[model samples]
Target: MSKRFSKIAAGIMMMAILVAITFTPVKAQDDNQNADLWQVYETTFKSAKYVDLTHAFSPTIAVWPGFGNATFRATTAGADLPGYINEGETYTYADHGFIATAYELPTDQYGTQLDPPGHWNEYGATISDLPATYAIRPLVVVDVHEQVAADPGYHATVADIEAWEAEHGRIPEGSVVMIRSDWHKRWSEVERFNQKPFPGVSLPALQFLHLERNILFHGHEPLDTDTTPTLEGEYWLLHNNYAQAEGVANLDQVPEAGALVAIGFAKPEGGTGGYARYIAICPPDWPNGVSVVEVPGAPLPVQPYPLRRDENGVLRPTPPES
Candidate 1:
């Protein structure tokens, strides 16, 4: 009878403890900041036109001669699968469930790239060290193509930037400024593309952009900042812990203002350079690019022609219905 009484008391105590726990108050969270951002994506981003400001790099694309060409081939299985295949066999869709390509990239600097300060400064930030806040920013394009057409060795000056500001108001703080020289037109001519006498950004123009206006970074169509004897512009930027974009393309398609840039890059550990993709998000009325609502790619469309491996080991699309 005493043992039964003790068990009943213990059970009552446990019930009281549970009741206290159930009544404890938690702080009320009324903020819907995430929902607000979702609304922005649905309204502004979904309707915006996106232009690819990046170049598709290939084995034959213009690269610094010191770094060799990249190679592509079918990925081979390293070990035998119990029921699927043997060791040292190349995986193909017909045999393995899917096909994968193995890329032998020689250097991270071979393509349209984001060059971190560590590319030149030993103690500076690497590619992975870049912050998530760098994902998007206002885009500013300064047209210097006419100057470049007149002189291939043209380097943009502070006056040019001032002229742009006078006409289009001050460049926004933390915006990305691209010096458009129409230099990407020579991309198909490998030797000519990398040759000297290419358009570049002058040191003064770069200084005004970052130091005075406080821009996030500046980009140019050419691979280097300038063909100057010492590349002083690039040297100063990296030493001062700034990043810049190289080998950017399609600037003529994007507007000079009222646009934003979506910055994306590969974050290899301790990488000095990043293979970057820059996309310009234009206003809905822009005629150049497609909107997210137009090409909502949850399930991507099928190709008109099947891909076939070419003699160069790169895959090419076959002729349709032939």
Candidate 2:
């Protein structure tokens, strides 16, 4: 009987030890999980405000050269008097009788032929049509417009990035660095946006971002990242050097940093540059990695309209002249 009691006591003691060991790890794991959750929450709740970088889209909106102008007008009448019935006299109508009314809404104009084509032949869509799969990457905004305007000699050179890094910290790896010249500021006037002389990324800048930094992609708000007049340096960077090798344009929608961008493609199948819904994903805090996918501020790309004047003292698009 004593022996039996000893065996039972030992079994009970072993069970208690096992329970204590198991419970401690479970408690520790719970504590770790709670800590992670708190970190995410704090990061999210802090970064609530988002800066809008995209210019508004409208017929009056400024566009680059070659792109069409925007236009809108009523296309159909909403109500009309009946031909068979008099207006003053009421006529009895049978049950199930029907009346028709027509109304028209204005169509949105994209731009002219001089405008940048919506899609590239290789990508099969415009920069806007980038898929959700691409959204996971980090976004970097390179002030190409401001930088170039400030210093015409400025190129995306090592010195330029080093200067920027000195001010903003290291450029995060595997991120998209957008060049913002506030070039979109010209959206309201075509000549101002496209014709205005301004310096763009120099070849050095292109090489630095592409080969040296191995940036995922580079984009600019301007029609092209390089300067106009087709300088040999610029040509070598884009066509000859193909430094961008693979990059995008019109990155005005992305924030300088701490933003996730998703480009929704039109999926035109075998077409160059399909229309896209450009979206920005910002975290709640500055940089904790929780994203709030925001809707795009710009309208979808479309064709341009003819210019016209409206009765309300507004400039509008008229039918194109033959």
Candidate 3:
């Protein structure tokens, strides 16, 4: 057999292993045992915690306006596989036969999905072209629940971001910012979450983060970044140069700062955005100081940032340092 084939077989075997590995974070067993506030926080925080930020997708889950519903079908089951044996009233499959399925996904935009530049720019970076590091970053939450509660179409403005900085300090240089409007609470019901009017980051907010703060990524509770298209008109902020997470939820569980988020998704070649699973990792206790502060306190070190899409819309990432 060819060396390549042998290596492939070995790799597959390693992935097929079903070893169970569980990691338990540090946590206080008893809080009422005469512990102080810090002690309680410490014990609770000692072990790290994780929160699921991805929305669950299903036939009943909400979809973008005018989009089609997802349909799942099992192509082949144990009884249908070749070499199957039939008993008196039951059926058994050969050891090699197993359940098989196929998906005719119309687009990857359904459910919780990533929005790489390719989603907008024809020559933009595709999912495969994105660096692995992009998936992980410090998590920052901007809560606009007050305004959202007042107005369903309230757009997060520059003032909102400035307020966040006022309390938490300037957003970290490479943090993944999430906008929360408490919309995730309506996830169980489709229309309430997807069809009803919602709030999201405004153009000015996106500009401040992308141009000035230089955040690693941005996310929102709604299906789209530009929620008020009639007033905002055209999703230039998302389509022009930035990649964001859409249909994200559970921001209420995350804090204003100090958490870390990791996004995992499949990379389908020649595809746009697709289903994704994003998780936020929270340390037992919030850090003593702000999660990240640079502008007023200290200047951030220079790091390679991807240059804006060229005139032709092709992304040109910076070269690695020597």
- Best candidate according to TM-score: 1
- TM-score for each of the candidates: 0.87, 0.51, 0.67
Write the residue-wise lDDT of candidate 3 on 1-322 in tens digits: 3454344334323322311111122243242333444443343323446678887675557777677666544343434434553322232134433433334565778888888778777877777777888766778899998899999878788898888888666788888888888877777877677764777778888888888999987888778776664534125654665678888888888767656787898888866786889888665343222222212325655547744333333334556567
Error of 2 at 301 (Å): 24
lDDT of 1 by residue, 1-322 (tens): 2443244334434444544444455431133333344555665678878999999887889998988889988888888888997887988878777887888998889789999999999999999999999999989999999999999999999999988887667888999999999999889999899899999999999999999999999999999999989999999999999999999999999877767899999999999999999999887777788998899977998766788777656887788664
What is the lDDT for 321 in model 2? 69
1-322: candidate 2 lDDT, tens digit per residue: 2443244334434434544544566667576553443444344423333443334344554444355544443223234456654443332223214332222213111321111123322322333443456544456666656565676444455666666666555666666666656555555555555554644566677677767776755555554455546554434443432322112334554445555555433344443332333445554433323333442335744437843446432345566768
* Pairs with steric clashes in candidate 3: 26-47, 45-284
What residue runs in model 1 are displaced by over 4 Å at the alpha carbon?
1-35, 320-322
In terms of lDDT, model 3 sits at 0.67
Task: Give all candidates' CA lDDT scores.
Answer: 0.86, 0.46, 0.67
Candidate 3 segments exceeding 4 Å error: 1-46, 77-82, 85-101, 230-234, 285-322
Cα error, residue 155 of model 1, in Å, equals 0.9
After TM-score superposition, the amount by which residue 115's alpha carbon in candidate 1 deviates from its true location, in angstroms, is 0.4
